[model samples]
Target: MNEIELTIEQSKIYNGVICPYCKGISEMIKSKEIYGKDYGWLYICKPCDAYVGCHKNSKRPLGRLANKNLRKLKNEAHRYFDKIWKLKILDRTKAYNWLSEQLNIPFDYTHIGMFSEKTCRTVVEISKRALNDNRRLDMDFGVEPVTEFFETI
Candidate 1:
């Protein structure tokens, strides 16, 4: 078998997380440098304008650095997926676990924050399918309607 070649971004030996745009190791900087207020720390690629926020007050990045388009996709994925738990269809942890199975990714790496654009799109498609399935079940069984269920919760 041939050996698989890893790109710079895919390699684990880099000193810091790679920027999706520039494919360079990112620099840790204050969020205020980009946001005008110190939201927290971030791993940033200044030339590419790609960045990822750190975990709360730490230097640890929440996920890979994303550009504007990736950021949009990530937000959209979260918007749809969050509803599964928000509507009590599944608890937050179970919802993530379900997403992990749907995406065929390991549970530990299933976070939307860490997903690429393709994965984010998959998340949106999976969530829409799940919501539709729930609606169909509700209708067929004459159980609580989807709209009413949301209103009551």
Candidate 2:
């Protein structure tokens, strides 16, 4: 990533977050609390069964805690969205820029981890549409990601 891209990603570092589902405070606990095995830390809301993973080796939450349904949507969103850059349709940064433009969201707010269900659906829709139109996208941009996105998220 360039200095500017690095700066943008670093700017939104999430230290802690209120649970979006229940409006409760999330607790930072070992991943085993929910995963049945230790992987890393997770910020979670017990009553609502909502949770979000943290960045590796950090106490900061990745994003807002998600309920089960929203988590599924996030996975689907990633599946489609990742392909755009993975297949070299556009360079990772440009792929995100394209998504940002298409979604009319700012580039800094474009990560799928922070998206709501509605936005996740839109991401899937647009990503699928873009992937289907990959040849044109490849011809149009002919670029793809400098670094891998977070897999645990």
Best by TM-score: 1
* TM-score per model over all chains: 0.80, 0.77
Error of 2 at 65 (Å): 0.5
lDDT of 1 by residue, 39-153 (tens): 8998888898788887787877777788889889999898888988998889999998898888887777677778889999888887877887887788999887553322111
Off by over 4 Å in 2: 1-15, 135-153
Q: Write the per-residue lDDT of candidate 2 for residues 1-153, one digit (tens) a residue.
A: 222342332333333456766666678899988889887899888898888898888877777688899899999999888987887767999999998888887777777877889999888887776665664444557645233332221
Evaluated against the true structure, the overall lDDT of model 2 is 0.74
Give the whole-model CA lDDT for all candidates, comma-separated: 0.77, 0.74
